[model samples]
Target: MDTNHNKGDKSFKIPGDWIEQSKQLKEKFSTLTDHDLKFEEGKEKEMLERIGNRLRKNREEVLNIIKEINLS
Candidate 1:
């Protein structure tokens, strides 16, 4: 997995356990469908943007939610 982290940037790695994390996300946000959390290689940015847009949240907020899932 190509995980990158940069300060003040909306760049972060999709966790290796993304499949599990995505499942958690779907549970947290019941409205999210399988298509919403689909992970396409090389399209991580697009996926994140889609998630943020669907949830009406910013990139940072989305990242935080994903991060919280990883920590759990």
Candidate 2:
């Protein structure tokens, strides 16, 4: 379903509590939608691309944003 063909950000992995983290991201970044935050196995890069594109950021920024969110 992910149309991102960048083949980059291969080292990125979704957090264990990605569902919760995703909610936090959605709140922090209103432009992000459920579809953009959706996580499928082995699809981290694609999801990152969607998030980065929506937020007008790069892959690293997106990765950092996801890492900065706390699941607590």
Candidate of highest lDDT: 1
- Tens-digit lDDT track of model 2 for 11-44: 6767678888888898888889999999888887
Model 1 scores a C-alpha lDDT of 0.85
Each candidate's lDDT (Cα)?
A: 0.85, 0.83
TM-score of model 1 relative to the true fold?
0.80
Clashing pairs in 1: none
RMSD per prediction, one decimal? Answer: 5.5, 6.8
Tens digits of per-residue lDDT, candidate 1, 1-72, equal 876666455556797688888899998998788888898888888888889989999888988899899898
Candidate 1 wrong stretches, greater than 4 Å: 1-10
